[model samples]
Target: MDSSSSVKIVSKHFVKPKTIAEESKQPYYLSPWDYAMLSVHYIQKGILFHKPIHYSIDAFLEKLRESLAITLVHFYPLAGRLSTIKTEIPKSFSVFVDCNNSPGARFIYATSDLCVEDIVNPTHVPLIVHSFFDHHRAVNHDGHTMSLLSVQVTELVDGIFIGVSMNHALGDGTSFWNFFNSFSVIFQAQEINKNDDLCLKNPPVLKRYIPEGYGPLFSLPYSHPDEFIRSYESPILKERIFSFSSETIRNLKAKVNQVCGTTSISSFQSLTAVIWRCITRARRLPLEQETSCRLAADNRLRMHPPLHRDYFGNCISALRTAAKAGELLENDIGFAAMKLHQVIAEQTSEKVSQMIDQWLKSPFIYHIDRLFEPMSVMMGSSPRFNKYGCEFGMGKAVTLRSGYAHKFDGKVSAYPGREGGGSIDMEVCLVPEFMDALESDEEFMSLVSF
Candidate 1:
């Protein structure tokens, strides 16, 4: 069969909670951090199961649906929808989740002739992999209580691919992973015995109140979503995955240490520095132009009374550092690596508290649109997420992939390679012009296995 016609959607439906949760009627308030993600609707994650498994498609679907239903009971807020409310305290508009359980999470079952070997081992993943997902279910165009999570399971010739799209405002990457891991555990339990009353090992804490250290930041004035809600659109956008072996990473770290005359930096820091420097050079911006690297710093553990690892909300803050284009290009990788370390280190609990306190005092939420330009880069996701642990009775993921919407110029994502043992896969997006430069850059290509 031709690749385009190989995949077919068998069915689409919603997986409701097994039982109505007590908190189903309660409203879940959006935290200040959560509000920051209001402009972005959803995040898409995919995992490929390549190893042979014994279960049939029918059995696997039953396990996934049953487990997902139970998981939704614990993560009940995900079964809700987003709403704009008028608060009496400040007489202002606020964004809140109406846990009305109006519509359950969407689930799709699909079949494909595509082999896992063709998709999992490729350095440049084809964009068609996105077709396996019901991508439209994620965006709430009508702005009503709909599904906050959408999942698609595509059976391949050799394995299965599970694609998940979760509302960005509902939670961060940590929350998403927690839900997936919990769901996997339930699935595993079901696989062992047909009838099992499984409970989440780490049930989510869905309290709407922001912890005290986060300060008295209540609802701010709501603005027109169009201001910060613009989707990335470019005429010549392209995305490709670049693999870096453990040996390459070790060599890069050693080079960074040698340049800095110190061995304190981590592989993440070194690799990020190398990528940033190479990108800056590829852009070939003016010497005086400013270039910045933006990333998210998880603040769940940085707070005074640290939040539980299972805190089900956005417990992260944005971190940015900038240097002149000339300086970022001229400086060695270690210099950039040191700067990255310093910026991350500065996100201490005390510092985060002060930052939130300052934001609270402001009368309105500031909307800073990150323009996608050659001179700027924004990093998404991280290498530390437990991508390999999402085993749903079949086997651990052989490889991982992200959504196509991330294919905007200046956007990047990093994930653990399926090969494991400190390997990293970098998914990069750029305009054709800069992408050509990046591909031809000898130093960058030397480190990546293409």
Candidate 2:
């Protein structure tokens, strides 16, 4: 007999214990969301979909067991409280002993939204499950917990998807990427010390010293939350994807800059402008609609040793950009790229690093975050995740998608990985009609492969 490794092959989700520091970190309140990070070694969750990716009643749980030996961890009911105060990591992290004995993971089958999932959705915000599959993490940002990525087997037609729900209080995209990359290493018989350079060395950086007029923080005239939700109504969680040859994207970046008269814009900036343009027209808003949204810019470069490839765990900040929708598209792609570069630069550095720290340290943390929660959207990049290579040698993931529906109601995501060397895969979910129009457009299709 062999000892169970941190990684194992399984068909279900599992829960694990939080680390020493992880247990100690308390949830800090920020607006409607929290500021915190939990190293619940593995909150492995997955969905079982049938062939063709439809619901099926044939799925069952019986005598399903594996030697997971993972640390037992559960979500501490924030009861809606923040998750990054000064709580203990390993000890305060033990909310499982307090669990009402809820089974760790349950796989269900349902065809219609009305039939399958409605009955079994977790009634609580932080769901706790027990199992041995260590492949995912979920977090609650504001209105909903945002799941990063999903790991699942395909439904024969080469289609499979996983939905992760997580809280934004946890580290940032850098943090999530750290854990995910560690997961891959651990899964492949590699060593992973949380403090490893591949991960964060010290704890997460929480400094907040943002200048009053700093950042792309221009107040927009969007309607109230109630009014806003109704008009911008659609899926609260969205799954948008973009594809292109990795090489093609690099080339396009240069090409757009050449034509747009500025080298400030990169592939992401140019493509983002395209998405913004399409989105603006889709809503039939005035051509001058001042689109407001935020971007998660990596701050690894600002760290002393620089997070480098070593530092990890939420090492990023948010940047809110504002400009006329028409102007955004009306300008050369290069100009759009320049604005994006500037907006992104504002979010990085010790300034934002310290600002976030002070904000979290303040009593007005909750109040300040809530003020902006209703008026903004957050956009992230999947360009560097390299998810396609996660196949464990079976094969590249047939499809990699995010569980972000309305998280970015005005979300602008650009991930150009998939198709071998230079090809990119781009996706977006706006009004169904808007998506349909993009899908129907022959000119757009010429540039992108569905």
Candidate 3:
């Protein structure tokens, strides 16, 4: 089958570790952030490798399975299943994971006649590339499907695509990347006759401690993950991927600073401001309509004494900035960028700590419905994630994509361009009319490569 057809599964099985660490064979508690995500699995992500390997398909699958199993020995929570607390007591309603005898992650081997060139075609049909991933295993839930990690490796004409579907409740982007890097390290060690005793580059720390007063706050009922699933299925949506050159980004930063009469402005502030403006303009919201730019900020270092880089689970806070549609459209890019900068400035480590403290008093509920409402956009992922570093004995990935971008509307996923250095890629999903307007946007098109 080609890119347009369903991915045919050649083989599928679980990849359990040959032996589990004695310390890991116990229940792992979910942090407040993690428990908050147990109701949804919106954090699925994937990367594509375009390098050709000399090994046969069977050999490649075997190597990957073996390395992943070894990697799971260190990052074992992913091998387990989430167990909701079963009691009428308010405090007992929280969820935790039973790590003992976990069935392990799912690994699937598949193939397609689709060429790399066709998969990246600018004029390709919408959602055609999503066939490269097994979406149901990531977002859908059933009695039989409990694995937190699901991987599908498809052999393309010229290269291979490794798609990872991770449950948000299991961990955040940091944990996901940590597991991937550990897997790569093990795979590389096995590939070459290197020392097998190489310590885990970033060993996971899984002890979860809930701040005092966190339990009583989450007692309120909120929308279910199933409702999110229903609202996220937008057949009328269109997803577009664009690459911004490092030079263009630099130019944008300089332009914003010059216009704003300021000396300092981050690339994120400038670029995201530009895209936010374009998306707002494309939507053509009325002047009085309010718009919000919600950017996911990693809070790993936001608390005093900072969470370790290897601290597993969700440690993100969405910093939002709101403005009137007319003001956003009428003002120059610098104004919007300055507003973004102010938002970032307001989220200091103290502020984040305060937010966490307040969260224990009243847990935050993620409202997926807000994304579908008019004039709002949620931005996620980052250039700082460095997906290219996920080398599994193969060379760096030729490109990276989530593949399942059609699952939501008005969502933007950003990543560092594989071209190296400061280049960036913005994967945007919007309703068809707004996408059309964004495509026809002269200013936006001038700065971006389709």
The residue-by-residue lDDT of candidate 2 on 209-249, one tens digit each, is 12344321111122222211221223433244545666656
TM-score of every candidate relative to the true structure = 0.89, 0.58, 0.91
Best-to-worst lDDT order: 1, 3, 2
Off by over 4 Å in 3: 1-4, 51-53, 89-92, 124-126, 135-144, 194-196, 212-232, 371-373
Worst 10 residues of 2 by lDDT: 62-71
| Backbone clashes in model 1, listed as residue pairs | none
* Deviation (Å) of 413 in candidate 1: 0.9
lDDT of 2: 0.38
> How does residue 79 of candidate 3 score in lDDT?
80
Model 3 worst lDDT run, 10 consecutive residues: 135-144
Best by TM-score: 3
Task: Compare candidates 1 and 3 on lDDT and give the better one.
Answer: 1
lDDT of 3 by residue, 263-382 (tens): 778887898998989999999899889998988888877667678878888888778898999999999998889988998878888887787777666765454554335567777888
lDDT of 1 by residue, 1-450 (tens): 255646688998888888886768777777777766665547788888974656678877887998889888888888777777555555555677776736788889988878887786654566667776665423432235456788899988888899888887778888988888888877887778754466667888877537466522356554444433445443456678888998889898888888888888889888888888888888888988988887767888898878887888888776888889888877767778888878988889898888767666653332234433456777878888888889997677877877654456777888887677888988888877888899989889999975
